[model samples]
Target: MHMVIYALVEASTKDEALAAGKTVFDRLVGTDAHSCAVFDYYVTFEEEDTSVAGKARWGDLPTAVPVDSDDGEELLDRGWEATKEEFERNLERVREALDEFSNEEIMRDEDLARHAFHQVGAYDGPMVFLYTEHASGIRHRGQLDRILEESENPWIVPADVHF
Candidate 1:
């Protein structure tokens, strides 16, 4: 899948931001707009530093470190095999945190977790990279951070997932 990101570029006006964003977007997706959603609007998205990306680059996604030369789906699957219990526990926590939401929302989130397991195929791993298609998961960043912190090999939420 194509990447989804909200970037900050130096600009003096809205038009400038859109122009810069489009330029970056075009370069990222190779001018092939059909790959991912593209939008331009006024928004203030909170960004945090990624461990894999390092503290200096706050908004960018983390890069993947190939595991024994394996990358993509294989890496993710292997990680899952290695840490299935921890991953499941993390999901249980998500469900608990999301209890205020409707059953549909919770199920959707569970599905998102599963999809992340399947498709979070690349990352800088000492721990498996946990990711989701839903940017809204950013709200629970602290939970992810805590989970990672407590782990022997932490699961990182990648800033980006290659391939």
Candidate 2:
């Protein structure tokens, strides 16, 4: 499954978006940010924010961006920053985990584990205005509303268009 999200997170400063990304990533991957296998689905904006907006085929992903599974992103990101051998080991574990979770039911909207405002990109305030080939989770605005419920953030309540 694939997803697009608009989130208001506590990330007013640079790199703060990583925090928001971690929360969303954890929900989708079913892993925590501090785990040994976390992934970042977001793409960097070249000296800007990160957005988690894309489809992840099992084997098409790069070693830099690991696929879902709770803390895989955490592990992968750190390992990618660490020595080569450690990075390879972490990447191996993440691939194995993604294979295991691919066949399972997704964590669902109820799995919103972070405090932020989230919504599907098609939302046009009370209705879906547009949509794309992003996973078929668009017709469920009610579910999106629940997941994107208001969550106040002081530092930065960053927003995403389709991330």
Which candidate has the top score in TM-score? 2
Judge candidate 1 against the unseen true structure and give its global Cα lDDT, from 0 to 1: 0.35
Worst 10 residues of 2 by lDDT: 113-122
TM-score of 2: 0.25
For residues 1-163, could you state the per-residue lDDT of candidate 1 as single tens digits? 2122332233444445445544443433335444342222111112343343223333432233222224323434433443444445655655554555566765676546534443233221212333322221222346444533443422222233222
Number of residue pairs clashing in candidate 1, backbone atoms closer than 3 angstroms, sequence gap of 3 or more or interchain: 3
Tens digits of per-residue lDDT for model 2, 1-163: 2222322233344356445544543443335444322123333222132223322222122211211323333432332233233334444554544455443422331223111122222222212211111212223435433423442331111112222
Segments of candidate 2 deviating more than 4 angstroms: 33-163
Model 1, position 116, has a per-residue lDDT of 41
| Model number with the top lDDT | 1
- Weakest lDDT window of 10 consecutive positions for candidate 1: 37-46
